[model samples]
Target: MPPLIDHTTHFIAGRWSAPDTATFPDRNPFTDEVVAQVAAGTRQHAQAAIDAAHAAFPAWAAMPPGQRQRLFLAAADIVERRAEDFVRLLAAETGTASGFARFQIRWSVDLLRQAAGWGYRPAGDVLRSDTPGRFAMAVRKPLGVVAGFAPWNGAFCLAWRTVVLPMAFGNTMVLKPSEEAPLSAGLVLAEVLEEAGFPAGTFNVVTHGPGDAGPIADAFFESPHVRSINFTGSSATGRMLAERAGRALKRIVLELGGYNPLLVLDDADLDLAVNTTAFGAFFHQGQICMNTRKVLVDRSIADAFVEKLAAKTRSLPMGDPAAPGTVIGPLINDRALAQVRQRVDEAVALGARVVTGGRANGRVYEPTILVDVPATAPVSCEETFGPVLIVQPVDNPEQAMSEALATPYGLCAGILTRDAQRGLALAERFDCGMVHINGATMAGEPAMPNGGVKDSGWGRSGHYAIEDFTEVRLTTLTQGALQYPV
Candidate 1:
């Protein structure tokens, strides 16, 4: 492994500088080793970041949208140039499969390019004139500074979607990358922005623990200069940020948690459906918010599909993350590993049988499958965020749909069926924000909106992520008002 570089300086006001206090260490999950250290942005440091963004907002926002677009496009090209290394680092630091990491890099590059194009489109519409000598028109204006907080899973794309896209639309941003996966963000972004020739302070990356983030969030919420907040994380955390931002009258975009389900109807293509469900549920060791957790199969085909899924899941390779043949890697950290164990244990204690794999070796939990899972089990209700699948038998498509939507969370879900109508109908009735019929619930084109409903989350990200971070100030220009106007 390459020696990790130290990012102990907070990137603020265009350059990096050491903070006033202690530094934070980033550990490699695979080896249980400390690979690098990052600057701990204290309350003062967080305030400094907000202040720098606040100061830079006017200049950044005032720049022509085309210039911003060019800058983002350049950055996108730079990312593409270094795609292989980016994927390697992502796999190294994030414990993500190399293939999935590569996909993320490719997807993120495309997303950035698409977001750059959105900068050129007209943002506001012209209003109709009421009468003669009266004309009406409207123009859209950029919001002020935006604060984006992104999580570790798919961090590169999530962070890019949260910040760069919005910044392309003329919003200055103070971005807080997840401490767990800080390197790829800062290193890659630095290279990209340098290639793009963005103005200093237009985008800044601050590395710190969660404690440093709260003050930054609060500062953005309270300050008049900061107009919006974009966050991607758990539902509980999203709710907290939304509430706080609401109190401060700030616009917010939240892409939160998901306990996704895959409904297998009686008319489903069993081979294709089982394979799709396996990847949808087991990929990235089920770290994705959209990864399928529950498999609701029609009782008629339940046994067959379950047997097939179990057999395939049993064959998933669990070993070194860098190995070409490895399918499942270790959990991100001890905390996540413990959480997976607890959830599995709680479900089994509640009568959910372990169908195949359920045990853990250090941070590596075997790709687990559960059957006869009580709807009331912890794994059933909560987003397990691990490689665990619960198989349930439903009497019909309606019952499967009901079981799928029984939980309050609805981020993403997949339906596998040969009957096109049944799959489409099931997709419509399902409560998730993103629904897949024949395909698995994997990352799609960045231009398509992505987010969830219910406790899963509110608002959307990707193509529309910029919309959440900016306010639409409709400038209505009128020559004169009606004679009767007060």
Candidate 2:
């Protein structure tokens, strides 16, 4: 039987509100079956949600930090208690494996707890001025109404960063989730928020069809009441959002595309390198924004690494994402599957060899590995965003960093080296946002700063989140009135 999921309304102003527009079907990627019908919100609905958030801002932001902290954790606890249902829906709608779905939900809960800690954190710093009797200080203030656009993959994490952070920082938010896999996670959180005693207008959600992004984008970008926009998606969309939001002088935080590289040094541990780096490529079927796409192995170890990596890739269970012990899940949709196959086919045409799996059955693409891929091949250079790994041989550490930097994206990179000093040095030159030594690029450390540079988009995660959602106000006062120089 199909997993039960019946969310068909927008969670607006702390209520289950129906959309004015027609609804769309949320289909299971693997089964190609309709799980539920989801409401498709329009520009008018987005504006209404923003208006509600605008109305709720003052009261919500004025509430005590401690109160906000308590409410956030309360909502988080609610979600945690019902993890089983969430995990099932997550797997069903988003094509996330049962284990990964659980991880995504668990990680979101953990991130919520981490966000709650920031409620009590210091808002700003007091400064000592050079001039006598001068009092100077910079304080953080909430951006009144924040508009958040989250993608389908990892809806929980994106929702927490995009909406929950704004609420935790005392601001109100209007979140618009991707229509394909939007309902369950967003609706659950909204219900949890209401049950946790949040105000009616404190947080709102607007779901729309994937084809309906233009109207929603226009709504958020053109709205004067929306103080900022937080987006996590493709570079094309992020650039569009940045350009539109910049014209209106609204703050923008984008976590965009990533063609992350994983380098295996000649002296690295073969077992550790193959296992961890394969995890990076195959995790979430490489749908993660921070997944490792290019695997650069030293000439001394390239053949050995490929042998082990191929065996590991062949071992990954592919089929129903909801099944136990399955790691390789379906692509989010057909286009995603095509993109993966196109990369592999193109690489093969250009003389790259497929080490193991290289075919797709509907949305399920086998975990594939291609060897002898040149640096310029599309598979190695482009963001495949699938469970496909392209391994290239590098002469040395210098060559590895040079090739990794050649890509237009700079989100995350993985370096596998037993030498601590060498790994740190290479990390400094990788030109990406985060680097994990001897680990996969898929790890998201909530306690530490995250995000990327270059085309990967600006802004950081974690503590940088507060700055993204809040504005810093500086004020300096003198004890007495000073004479005018003019």
Candidate 3:
């Protein structure tokens, strides 16, 4: 094996190991500098990690919950002490603003702490039994050898969140982090797990350089030992994985593509609406799965809303994430940059008007706004994972609601209005799983249920996350024998 570069190593069976395949430089999206050399991990590497997890599962599950809790708390402390370092690592690797990077670290740490506390809680329910002298209940048990896929977008937050809950519930996981942003999987969570004294193989990482995730993912589906799968990525990719999971009879969770919508009503506070919508559309350079892809605004207030949004977007700084006040950073890689440019160009050709800021400078694209874009345009319907906002005018509340729910992808939806009652009513009509009432459509807390319906996500976050990581086990105890079957 060749000499591994900094930030390049896989954590398997509790130790850092070298990759078997060739390595590639994982570049910083902003300056195109090689932040780390990542391993182009193969299916064998993936299976080896899975094998380790499978070997470790019985011991991990048998360990006392309090012991597990204490270890997790130790891990949380270690992470909190050096939280700023991980924040910097996240921004450099993923082109996220420093503030957002801090948010990711803070949330991830909180999630770990929260997972630790789950030890005190019961995993399932005790139910009443009809038979005399019988006890019946359902308990949640760890699903052995989980396979996790973390996408490039929100790598820091999603990657750690995926593994934390599973590990907390005593399930061993092998994570296949995205090649574009894989360092955090090893440097942050894996390091914490090792330091906190997790037994060998409790947590594992398999990172591949660009275009190498497919084989590893396939191996995950093919492996009978992998009892559960957790994936976060594009809907197109999620479908293929879901199919494989079905064939393999493995439990699966997929958080996929989204065309989330933000509705700005005539009654909304214009300033707040503009700021929220702008942030929703452009935060992390619009790389989020929950970004506001389509904005359905009341025609009476749409003009002013769009104008103010454009102005606010212009004020957001776009450059090196290390610099102070750089709100907008570069896209993940060349493919993302080119996709944004192509979508905007195609939308313009479809008669949309670029209000301002349509320039793409290498990996960095300025936060942009498009007006008069047809509601049915490709950019309007598709997930344009870029810092561009497409605005469509609607005549009334009914039209706005109709337009917002028309998309095939239903991850998240929101409405801005002063009437709390009406806002609640309107929000309930959204086809998506999550509804935001004057809230930032793109934002979610660690404590909230983070997954979506339709193409947004199959499994959930928060309390439900534990349920997904566990399989139900029902135990019935009876004295003597009950009556024969009915």
TM-scores for candidates 1 onward, in order: 0.95, 0.96, 0.95
User: For residues 1-486, what per-residue lDDT tens digits would candidate 3 score against the true structure?
Assistant: 222223477777877775455778877888777887777788888888999999999999989988998888888798788777776777677887887887787888888888887766787788898789898889988889888888778888888877887787779889988888888755567877777898989888888877667788888888888999988899988888888888888899888888988888889999999989888889889999988887888899888888788888889888888777889888888888889999999888889999988998778899989988875567888899899888888898898887787777878888899999999999878777788899878768877887778877688887668778888899988988778979
- Candidate 1 structure quality by residue, lDDT tens digits, 1-486: 665443446777777774555677777688767666667665666667778887887888787768878887888888888887776677678887787787788888888888777776777667776566654556556777888887888877777777765786778878777888877755456546755888877777777764566665666677777778888899999999888987888888778888888888888888998789888988888998988888888889889998999999999898777778788988898889999999999888998899899888778889999998887888888999899998889898777777777888878888887788877776778777899888887746787778888887777766576556555554445466557656
Ranking of all predicted structures according to TM-score, beginning with the best and ending with the worst? 2, 3, 1
Please give the CA lDDT of all the candidate structures.
0.78, 0.84, 0.83
Per-residue accuracy of model 2 over 1-486 as CA lDDT, tens digit each: 654544467877777874455788889888988887778888888888888999898999899878888888887898798788888888888888887777777877887788887878898989999777889999999989988887887776676777776777888988888876676546656767788888898999888886887887788888889898888899988998899887999999989999998999998999999899888988888888988898889999888888888888888899888889888889999888878888888888888998898988778899988888865678877788888888889899888888888888989999898899999888888788899998899878666678988899988778668878888999999987676689
Query: What TM-score quantifies how close candidate 2 is to the native fold?
Result: 0.96
Error of 2 at 386 (Å): 0.8
Better of 2 and 3 by TM-score: 2
Error of 2 at 401 (Å): 1.5
Off by over 4 Å in 3: 1-7, 19-21, 482-486
Candidate 3 to truth, TM: 0.95
Provide the lDDT at 222 for model 2: 88
What number of backbone clashes does candidate 2 have, counting pairs of residues 3 or more apart or in separate chains?
A: 0
Position 1, candidate 3: lDDT: 23
